[model samples]
Target: MLAVAAGCGGGGTGADHSTMNRRDGSASPGAAGHNDADVMFAQMMIPHHRQAIAMTDLVLSRASSERVRSIATQIAGAQNPEIRTMSGWLRSWGEKVPAAGAKAGGMDMADGMMSDADLAKLKAARGERFDALFARMMIAHHDGAIAMARDEQSDGRDPDAKRLAGQIVRSQTAEVRTLRGIAGGR
Candidate 1:
């Protein structure tokens, strides 16, 4: 019976202690419940959504077509609240809420974000030219957001975070199709 007791005790020798405690040796209540993917999704998406809001603001000022203006308004309405929601999640998780003006160069380029030059060009464009550029750029931007949301759905652990990710995927996927139609001059 002693031999059996010792064998069972040995099973914990190589156990992962990180799961029980944080790196700083503090007992983490929430750390064990959430994963890296959940943290990353909020971090990256906050800035992505901020940029989308910025793009929409620019288009709303110069777009000649009412349809373009309406779309831009809708984009801003949806994303501004989402930005706040994700920021709240990061705060609750004890993670850094990325600064509003922070550059997102470290994020995946294939995630469909625009470059500085692209924004500058959009800023310079007006009327019909502005509408076309806005449509094209926003289409790509929404595609990137959809990709990140999909990753969160697959890899995230927190229920609230996963639910928000699923929502982003569905809404942004529809927006992509609409933006594409506008870009194609429909």
Candidate 2:
């Protein structure tokens, strides 16, 4: 199901230790090779990504056009693996990873996470309404991710985590452009 957008180019599970991520899941807490910025990036982005995945799942069936569904698939393909990768980093760092697949909540709207009411509205939308709302919300969501990735690039100490942050910026920034087009420049 997540492989639906295999060719769309959302980064991977940080499998390439040579470049994107150097830390392995087996590394002990003392050997995590990460700083607080890396930990915060993993902790925050994991749930952020989960929320995006949840939205994609909802949109796939209800989207009026094939294009929207395709984007949803792309997002899931990219993010689901990244979530696993981040969770692995957290575990290696001896941090408490949020429960797997936790729905987005509690984060302030300024952080770009949708509130319960927003999710409920999205859940209740249909046809073109869903498409428009999704484009708007996802663009906002992607912007949030880009911001966090930028923070990691600035404050994170691990080369692997910084590489992953760069990947996130590139991918999600592109997604924001596409989503803007989908939103008719709104």
Candidate 1 Cα outliers beyond 4 Å, as residue runs: 1-32
Candidate 2 lDDT over residue span 31-147, tens digit each = 325666676677778888888888998986677866678888888889888888887766766677878667434355555688879989999998888988998999888877787
At residue 149, candidate 1 shows an lDDT of 78
- Model 2: colliding residue pairs: none
Model 2, which residues run further than 4 Å from truth?
Answer: 1-24, 28-32, 101-106
What would the TM-score be for candidate 2 when compared with the true structure?
A: 0.82
TM-score of each: 0.81, 0.82
lDDT of each: 0.69, 0.70
Lowest summed lDDT over 10 consecutive residues: which window, candidate 1? Answer: 1-10
Instruction: Count clashing residue pairs in model 1.
Output: 0
**Candidate 2 positional error at 132, Å:** 0.7
